[model samples]
Structures are given as C-alpha cells and as structure tokens.
Target: MTTATPYDAMFSGVIGQDYEMLKLLAPLAVEMSRLVGATVSQHPKTDDKPLSVVELGGGTGITTLSILAATDAIQLLSVDNEPVMQGQAQKKLQAWQAQGKLAFCLDDALSALQQLANGSVDVVASAYTLHNFTNGYRQQVISEIFRVLKPAGQFVNGDRYALDDIDQHTRTTQTEVGRYFRILTAANKLDLLEHWMVHLFSDESENHIMRESLALQQLAAAGFAGIHLSNRSEVNALVTAYKPR
Candidate 1:
C-alpha cells in the first residue's frame, strides 16, 4: 500500500515554474493572508448566519486556507479562471468544501464579481493576483467589489504595489531582477528565469502595475472608507478598506 503524498508537499510540484518564481513573495503572502483572517474575525456573524466571503483568485488554496482557518462560520466562494490552478486548490481544500464551508466559481474575477448580488458578501479578498490585470480591468473589479459588499464590508488585498517614485521603482526592479538572475542561474533554471523576467516586466508595465498611491486613491474613489496600507515588504503590500455603513 502506498501512502498519499501530503498536499503541502505536492503543492510546489503541481504549480511548476510559478512555484519557483513566486516563492519569493511567499513571506508577503503569509502576512496578507493572516491579515485577511484577522480582519474577517472582527466582523461578528449576523443573526447566526455564516459570514460570506468572496476570494478574488484562489491560487492553489494558499489564501483560502488562511481564511478558512480563521473561522468555521465562514462561507467562502473562491473565484479563479485558470482550471489547473483551481483544480489544485480544490484538491487541497476538499475537506473545507465537504464541510460546506467553501465553494468555487471557475470564472474571471470581474465576471464573477458582476454575478454576485449587490450588498451580498461580507468580505472581498485577494492575494498576489490583482496586479497582473490591466488598470482598466482592475478598476472595474474594484467597483464591483464595492458594489457586492454589504455595508461596512471589507476588502483586503496582499499584492505587489509598485512604488510611487519612478526612480525608486526603477532601482528596486533592477535589484530584484539581478537577484532573480543570480538565484535562477545557480539553480540552472535559466528557462524559468526568462519566463519570470518577462512576467516581471509585464507586472511593471504602465498598463499593468498599480502604484501604491494610486491603489489607495482608487479604493477611496470607489467609496470605501478606512482605506489604508496595513503592511508592506518591498513592493508587496497588504491594503485594507471598507464600505461605510
């Protein structure tokens, strides 16, 4: 009889190149996930009803695991368009789904948010996913997040937020790229190095990267109050905002 490989052990191999490149952001992701867990715990359940949470992109259940660990009374809807990534998440998080604490929507963030009823969910959360989108689409998703949230509901995100200073941003990106080249070269992962470098470029591009200052501005404009950067490590930031009651 063969023993099953633990989900945690299998996760890295399942995610492939993404695991190698994105492992750099793991520390920041942990902080972000913990913040989301803490913030949601602050909002008490209403009329014994479970707290409704809509997670924007459930990449292999990393963030989802954190949220579920926070409370058993949460109903989590994890939305992601990528089937492979979502499948991995589903497998890892099967227990939560079986317990009726989790469900998934295989759809893009904006479309999934659009389908949610206005003032329906208690929280909207994401990790390391939003910055990959073009500014226009991201704004649309933010507006939808505002719409779907119940009054006083929260939005928590942990993601790469480019620095507002162009000079500093450029210097930071250069240093990061240099480090990536050194590490990947040592690992003889030049193929992954090239892929990560291009992805990094796309992330830093004008139409894609959301500067830290700009994200706060967008959140405020969307009518979310208590907008603030809760945590930051290099370019990764955890931003929290709320719809006023």
Candidate 2:
C-alpha cells in the first residue's frame, strides 16, 4: 500500500546493491557503525524525553540502523541531500520511522545543522561523511555542531581520518584500492568497483581528506573539550568530543 516515489525508480536497485557491496568490501564501515552506535547509546540521559541525535549522511541507513539498534532511548534525525540515498535509508528504516523514533531531513549537512537551535541536540554523529566536505565548509559544519549541542552533549564521528603521515596514507590507499578491485572483480561487480574508485578519489582529494591532526585541532578549536581519537583502523577512526557544561 505504499506509494512509489521517484527515488524508487532511480535508486531502488543500483544504490542498494552498491551499499551491499560496500558492506562486504569495507570492514572499516562495520567498525564505524559500531563505534558511533555504542557512543550514542552510552550518553547519559538528560531528561525523561528520549535522547535527541542528529546523524549526518545517513547513507543507505547503515549508521542509522546502528544508532537505532543500539538503544530505544533515542529520537533521531538523519540528514542527507540525495533523495535516492535517503530513499534507500527510508526503505531500510521504515519501521523506526513508523514508530516515531526516526525522521529525515532532505538537506545538506551544514544547512541542516544550522537550522537546529542553539544548544538543542544531545548528540551529533556521522560515519564516513564529513571527510567528503570541502575544508572550509567542514569547518563551518564543525562550528555549527558545537553551536547546536547542549552543554555536555557529545559529537561522535567514525570516519575516514587520513593518517597524518602522508607516506603511510598513500600506501594505505593503494592497498585498499587494490583490495577493492580484487574483491569487486571477483564478485563480478565492476560497476560497484568503479563507483567506489570514484569515491576513493574524492576521499584522497587534497581539498577533502581531513587528516587526524587537523580533525583534532578543528574539534578543539570549535570549543569542544576532551577531543580525542577514540578508535582507529588505518585511516578510519572514531573521534569523540564533548561540549563543556
């Protein structure tokens, strides 16, 4: 009894298949989801109302599912500009949406964060999303994250935090790309491989990749306290910080 949206026509098959391929190929994604989910779940309750969590990206609902699965005490708003991507998420997380535990904002991350009132959110979380933003805009988004967080509210990001050592970063990227080609080719998923290669190129873009040192510096500069790398797997890392009470 569901109405078919335009996204269904465009992304219903290919996008979902691509994400499934990603899950198989990128183990770091699994870790990112786990870390972000556990971090959100562990936040101390502020009141009787469910914890309010804002998720950036929400691509295909992987991280969204993690956040929801980790706890029933959260009311989550997941933001993404891509209709097809969010549509994929909507399909995956329809139950939560139906239960009134989840919502979606069809907008860019920075703009969505800006719309939130000062000191409004309990946690801001993302996975493999912020590193794709242009540096200046990413900084603005970081500042806004600080602006919207209630005192003692948390920001947890499990993302591609490139190694500060350029040599190691390059070597790691090469190895990962090789693995991607091997895996996808073996699976006869060359189309997905191409998609991932393009994404990898974006991740390696000088204007985009947020190195570990810079990420910590930006979080600290944004007035977040106790900023630190909580978990790491090669360039993938879990960065956690909190707003001061």
Candidate 3:
C-alpha cells in the first residue's frame, strides 16, 4: 500500500514561496510575542499553571522552531499524522529538548486537542493544516479548539487565503497563480510540481481547499472573539482570534 509521502517539499513550493507567507511570518512572530506573554517552560508544570501552549498540525517542525526562536514559550506540544514529518521535526528540536524546550505527540488533530485539558493553554497554533479537510470535519475540529482554549486564551492559525466566493468571481489573479507556479519552477522539482499543480488545478479535491473567510466565520460562531488578520501574503493569510476570559 502507498501511504502519503510525509516529507513534501511541495508545500514550501506552494505556501512558502508566496511572498506573503515569508513577509507575514516574521511580523506574526513578533506580534505573537507581544500578545502572548508565555515563556518556554523550564520546569514541569500542570496545565492549570500559566502560559501553556499547544501547536496542532506542525509538520517537519520548521514553524515550531521559528516560534520557539521568536518567543520564550514552554509546554510546546506538536501534533501531526505523518511520522516521517514528525521524525524530521523531532530531530530538529532535539537539542532544545535536551535543554528542556519542546515535545511532540503523534495523533490526529481532534484527538490531540481533546487530550489537552479545557482552559489550559495560553495560545493554540496550527499552520496550513486547516485547508485539508471537508467543512464538517473542519467545523468539528474548530469546535474542539473552542472547547480547549482557556478563557481569554488565544488561537492563531497560519492557514489559507480567502479565495473568491462562489457567486462573485474574484480570487487570486492569474499573476498571483503564476507566482505560485514560478516558485515550483525555481524549486526545480518537476515531478512533484507536476503532481501538485495537476491536482490543485483539476479540482481533484474540492473539500480540501478551505475558504479562508468561511473558516474565520466558523471560528467566530464557535464563540471565539477578537478575530483579526495576523498575516497576509498574496492570497494566503494567517488569522488569529481568542476565546473570551
């Protein structure tokens, strides 16, 4: 049986090459530091204590490392379904963990969220993973997220762009689409590039492409307030919101 390749350089081909992803990622880190005052945990502490953080769908650990490098956060929990990706992440964060900095849990998103006690975390983060499921599953995942966050706790999602709605005909323009293509060209991985572009362009999976606005709205309806645009690049955006205290 053929399982999904966990180490997909194609993701960087799609999301990373977007000038917006690069630009917004830097500022988002600074903003996260300013907004969430949690420090990297030095000693073992219960979730009831202060400044706990859990990250869902962290693949290969690049973003996780970026967050740790940018902030003084503890109780770092990263979850993903792909073992190859998780292994890469574990290797990357091994040194920090040697000094007591990070940890990982391999599980599906909802189960991972459920494992955490309610109202325990200061911030919950997920990147680029929101756009992979159907609307119902997405809503269910968001509801679980709503349930886990501490009152006043923050959730920041470095996710997809708000594409054009069905009725109105507006989306990232051809030029922007070309930009995504250019990244693939530059990356020089033709086989992977062709596979992804074919799937993405052909609409092989409609439910997988989560509309950014609808996601924000759903999060809002789930009782998360203070929603705001945390990052934007061309068509992709990473939004943030909070569960009230």
Candidate 4:
C-alpha cells in the first residue's frame, strides 16, 4: 500500500468543495481569456487555427467551466493528478468533451506538459495550483510551459505570491488568516477553518510560494516576455507572461 504525502493528504478532501477558493477563478477566467484573445489577435497564424489551451491542476472544473463560458477556444486540455478532482472536472466538462472543446487528462501537470510537443500549445493557464510547488520545481514547470508554448503564446496564472519583505509577508498572511477565520466563524464552519489553519501552518517546502518579483524574474529567465501582474488582492495575484515571437 502507498502512503499519501502531506500535501496529498491535506488536499484530498478539502480542495474540491472550497467554493470560496473556486469562485476566484471566475474573474481570473475572464482575464485569462482576454489575454489569450489579445495574444492570438497579434499573431495571424494562431488566428488561422483554433486556439489550443492547456490548464494545469484543473480542480473541480471551476476554472475550466468559467473559461469555457467566457472564451471561445478550439481545444482545452485540463490536467490533474487527483482522480477525485479529475472526476469532478470530467463530469462538469462532459458536454465540452463531447463537442471536442475540452478534455481531462489524469496526470501530473509537469509530466503532461513534458509529453506535449515543443511550441505546440497556444496558451497555458492555471489557478491556485502552481503555488503548491517549491520555487525550484515551479521554475522547472515554468520552463516547460515556455518550451511548449508557440511564439507569442501566453501563460496566465492565478495563485498566491510571497511578498518580498518578511514583515509584509507576515502581515499579509495574518490578514488573510484573520479574514478566513471570521468568515468561517460567521458561517459556523469551525471544522473547515481548522483544516485550513493546519494547511496554512504546514511546514512543507512545496507550500512556499515565490514572491511576485522573483516569479516574474523566473519567467523572464525562461524566455517569457511581456510578463506582468494582471490582477492582485492581498497575496493572491493573476499574472500573465508571453513567449517571445
């Protein structure tokens, strides 16, 4: 029998039903579609074919459904390692799958991306997922995203970023914790709040999110141009970057 890692164990039942967390993807979907549309418009070859998009860590299909509703895309491949999460997404995206507009792959995001041909994808997007990777592994994932993207292809990601200053990071984390605590308490969901608190304080290296500046720097090093923070609230941010044409 295999034992679950701390990360897997923590997220096993908690991630899929977190409606508050999932709702953030709605606005992120709009922003991501806009960036994709803007980028495809700039490149005529992309306009000639249907846009191919890959979404990493597609939990519960919230982001996928939001994107599908907000954008017109030829193909979308949603990749995730968790079977339960994938099942949720698959159920939600069945109509799109039947229409050849969406598909779900049961695989790790990095492994799935590595299997794709270089410069084949038009866009890659993710929400609240990549932050689970350590800075080093996250950089590797960014590099793979860079490799797989066609020239001028875009990557839009919505996730938490570490603050550059220690004090600010602490304050931001504290504020977020307080906000969640109050909300959960008001909703009489102390059990859920406890689960979140435990995960928040977990000492896993993979839980360490990179600062926005460092993340942008990594994207630049991976040969992405036009990197920018498109949206932000407290520690969460939506960032967009492009592979140079």
Query: Best lDDT goes to which candidate?
Result: 2
lDDT per residue (tens digit) for residues 1-245 in model 1: 02483222212333342563555634456677777677767765656889999998887777888889987788999998877678878988999999999999998999999999999999998888899889999999999999999998889888888988889888877878888888778877776676666667778888998999998999999899999895777777788898999
> lDDT tens digits, residues 128-207, model 4?
77877767778889999999999988888877666677688789788777877777788777766766776666522434
* Candidate 2 TM-score versus the reference: 0.92
How well is each residue in 146-205 modelled by candidate 2, as lDDT tens digits?
A: 999999999999999999999999998899998998998999987667667766777788
Worst 10 residues of 2 by lDDT: 1-10
Q: Which residue runs of candidate 1 sit more than 4 Å off their true CA positions?
A: 1-21, 24-26
RMSD of each: 6.6, 5.0, 6.0, 3.8
Off by over 4 Å in 3: 1-50, 165-173, 183-188, 198-205
Who is ahead in TM-score, 1 or 4?
1
Ranking by TM-score: 2, 1, 4, 3
Worst ten-residue run, lDDT, model 3? Answer: 34-43
Q: Could you tell me the TM-score of candidate 4? A: 0.83
Candidate 3 has a TM-score of 0.74
Which residue pairs clash in candidate 3?
A: 20-233, 39-72, 39-73, 40-72, 40-73, 40-74, 41-74, 152-244, 152-245
Q: Is 2 or 4 the stronger prediction by lDDT?
A: 2
Tens digit of lDDT per residue, candidate 3, span 115-186?
A: 878776767877666666667778888888888887877777765545655433134435444654666568
Q: Model 3 misses residue 152 by how many Å? A: 0.4
